[model samples]
Target: MSGRPPGAKSVDQLLEEARSRITRVTPEDAVSRMADGAVLVDIRPQSQREADGEVPGALVVERNHLEWRFDPESDARLPQATGYDVDVVVLCQEGYTSSLAADALRSLGLTRAGDVVGGHRAWVAAGLPTTGGPAT
Candidate 1:
């Protein structure tokens, strides 16, 4: 007995589904992967990144164009979208959106894609390398 659109999954359900499909990394772990040549992609909008600060080497790919820019067969793909085996770590202001983005990337055949747990905020907290970013 709810006044709502049919077949609309709640955000909670969506989050659960997304997280189940990916192994999210901690901020420290993310930095470790970076050392090993993984790509840390920050999907937070420009405004948020400017406001909070940024991870120095993290690529700002934004959320909307991720699929196209990361798809191996797409012309819009970024140079870092090297191949299907590349480790792509998605990040946002928090962990939530990155989970969804990681899942999306996986669906696009980026099997190694994942997210940074707690996002940039956690990155800052762990004393990882970032520039002009959030105050942890």
Candidate 2:
């Protein structure tokens, strides 16, 4: 018998609640968008990326510097030479981190920002072509 409210959620449940705020898109959809000129931004750490071959044509932007680089307000930023309205998709190894990264990008006014739901692992699993380094 517990004294907590009937609907009270545990700590794990609360954290998961926050995680669900991020939107996710399927790997196939991401690929289609990429073919249509959407920039696929890989935010996996360099070591992981090097260990596992990267997606062909995906922009390699380390997670730590992603927000500053993508956020238009940040003076220490890379020029959005392709224009700010470009569709940008972020990816990580397992999809979790990329969701947060995409949400952050959306917060920074990148309305077209999104993340790969199944991530690079799913991309590889889906038989997509990759380049850079040897396959994991």
Candidate 3:
């Protein structure tokens, strides 16, 4: 049997859908948003994060726990607890996962949720600063 369910689209289709639903921003736009107080959520796994470094002020939240922590009703694990109303931008190793993560946030009622267009790769490619380890 194939991995796809009945009536389900292929990975390409899913990606296209995610792209349509997601609001993409460049690293420069992301910088402006961060300066203006938007929360940048890094959803890349800990291992990848360590290897690739991180954006200077990004919040490290594993992808699995993101919805609960940012949902407002639930007590957030992070020091900075945020509600769904917060302006949030999700990032991953590449642009793909961020779009999915951003869509999930929107489902949780974050109207302003979005993702970095090219994620950390693009950020690094654009010459943005990255921290050596997990954010403190």
Candidate 4:
């Protein structure tokens, strides 16, 4: 045995489970949805954003504060987090963390939560609009 608990799941397993709970969007699709008022939440850290650039107008909530900032019922929630029906599309450096973050949002009753497939790298690859250097 690898010494994990009886019911333990690997990171890959957790990621797979998270992805299954929501519909991931491509960079193009995410932009379209953004135009239609979807909230594009960027959860990358400052260092990553500094290196990879940022999505113009995307909410810059770092990963650590995501749950508090987006949780509708939380007192610390953002003004836009009015309810559970909000369309939240989370983005990370490479898509892995975003999937987990979106899953966490869903657990908080943000039923419309999802992530950008392939994350910032894909966005840069697709030539999507950004305000800084290309995603690394």
User: How well does candidate 1 match the true structure, expressed as C-alpha RMSD?
Assistant: 1.8
Best of the two (1, 2) by TM-score? 1
Q: Write the per-residue lDDT of candidate 4 for residues 1-136, one digit (tens) a residue.
A: 5599888999999999999998799999999888998999999999999888999989999999999999988999999898999999999999999999999999999999999999999998998888876433
Between candidates 3 and 4, which one is better according to TM-score? Answer: 4
Using all chains and alpha carbons, the TM-scores for the candidates as numbered come to 0.93, 0.78, 0.88, 0.95
Model 1: lowest-lDDT 10 consecutive positions: 127-136
Clashing pairs in 2: none
Candidate 3 stretches greater than 4 Å from native:
2-5, 77-81, 133-136
What overall lDDT goes with each candidate model?
0.91, 0.79, 0.84, 0.94
lDDT score, candidate 1 = 0.91
Error of 1 at 112 (Å): 0.7
Q: How much is 126 displaced in model 3, in angstroms? A: 0.5
**Number of the top candidate by TM-score?**
4
What is candidate 1's lDDT per residue for 28-110, written digit by digit as tens? 89888999999999999999988989998899899999999999999999999888988999999889999999999999999
Candidate 3 lDDT by residue in tens digits, 3-93: 7688988878877887787688998899899999889999999899888897889998989998888886776645454665688889998
Top model number, lDDT: 4
Instruction: Give the TM-score (vs. native) of candidate 4.
Output: 0.95
| Full ranking by TM-score | 4, 1, 3, 2
